[model samples]
Target: MEHGIVTFLTDYGIDGPALARAVEERGLDGLFLTEHTHIPTSRETPWPNGPDLPRHYSHTLDPFVALGAMAAVTERITLGTAVSLILQHNPIGLAKAVASVDHIAGGRVELGVGPGWNREEMANHGIDPRTRTARMLEHIAAMRAIWENDEAEFHGRFVDFDPIWSWPKPVRVPPVLIGGEGPTVLDRVLSHGDGWMPRRAGLDEIDALAARITELQTRAADAGRGHMLVTVFGVRPDAKELAAYADAGVDGVLFTLPAEGPDTVLPLLDEWAALVA
Candidate 1:
């Protein structure tokens, strides 16, 4: 069980199976692939995490391909697209891919998604930056329908699809996580998602958000959904800070290894294992 998993999020461009084997050998609980379709050298929007955050934000193999490879080799470790460029994908295609990956991994997959902010990136994929929020919400709705229904359909301003058969339905529907921090996004998370993952929303904010989420969960009890999880992002190795989050109702702490290579990564994994051990 994931008593406390030190999950990995990386721009890893290695043999996924071999890497996963190493992780399993050293005893890690899960592997998550962080997303970045590309990094525009000339960008206007500041990086969300911070100016000093490393370039691991980009420059890596596709998360899905890498996670799929990891799934092929690992017997029990969980796999996920920690946060995919969900806005850029066709809902049907993504639903199918997620189901396929979950099947290969014996039904272990969590779809962490967000309203992507990079303007150039969204434009490259022909998605209007102005409508990203609405687009993402519709995409979420459509993806859920495809996952939960044999003959799925959606009728919305942006995602109108006729009833159609979808196959090899996931043995279990993957958890849908909404990532982004803001009141509107929080409302969306409370109403639509299965979990809330506001990555890089510093510790203080996370503590406050945790309280707000509890209030929302209490309201949702009327609708029969009070078991949503809260997961921290880019978690550091400070035990006190980590404990603060745990005290705030967080269910997981997901972090990314530095972008350099395994030398920098394996030590951190060992350190993390020691902490949770």
Candidate 2:
């Protein structure tokens, strides 16, 4: 099994280019960046982890642009968005950005997507929280059509577009990992996404997590989706925890890096490198 790291990059935090270089140099599987266009002011939606959302949510840099910068400085290491909020983006434009990044990185891109948790945030992008799941599915389908075809079009209740052209259609259609632990998420992954990224906080036990993956795999088999991989995120930086995930048949375990400058982050990265070593 492979393991990766996800980090929130900001103007005030880690050196993105340097960290990417080290990730490749150290032989880590991949480095995924987190995203948030902007955090809305309304407090209608409480933070998923706690009562108050962390400051990093508002300060996180745009993953696509940041990852593009990282791609310009390094190669070999997989660079990806841990979970892009697709429900808030224009699918066509987002597709172009994704394709551009994938082309720049020579196909080392993973498009992990989610219909975010913040109602106020979704409202800022004119996305109704209630229909976000439907919109997200349509958004992904539309992006796929754009990625795999010269002349593409997608018609759905949430996303309806006529024939259009998008250039630099990725070196390869990047693998998509759907993020969330909703009741219908497995179905969505089997339908459109190439993998599933479930946060560790959502599953109560490793045994249960393994059971869920077994069920997903069985369902995927029934649906003729044999390539549906599993990557568990927000995992503790403990070897025992990682070993349990590996035993659970998780394809990858994503560790969260602290939001800090290189002086702080590099040492942490080195620590992680040694842990994996």
Best-performing candidate as measured by TM-score: 2
Residue pairs whose backbone atoms clash in candidate 1:
none
- Roughly what TM-score does model 2 have, to 2 decimal places? 0.96
lDDT, candidate 1, 1-277, per-residue tens: 1322323344453355666776676666667767777877778777766875365666667777777787888887777766787888888888888888888888878888887778978888888899998898888889889989988999998778999888767768888788877777767776678887776446667668667767766766767876776666677767777777776777777765555556766677688777766
Model 2 lDDT per residue over 1-277, tens place: 7878898887788778888887888778889988888997776787877897888889988899888888898878888888999888899999999999999999999988888888888888887889988898899999999999999999999888999999999999989999988787888888889999998843348888888899889988887767578987778778888888888889988889888887887787778788888
Candidate 1, run of 10 with poorest lDDT:
1-10
Q: What is the TM-score of each candidate against the true structure?
A: 0.89, 0.96
Collision count of model 2: 0
Which stretch of 10 consecutive residues in model 2 shows the poorest summed lDDT?
Answer: 200-209
Where model 2 places Cα greater than 4 Å from the true spot, the runs are 201-204
TM value for model 1: 0.89
Model 1 RMSD, rounded to 1 decimal: 2.6
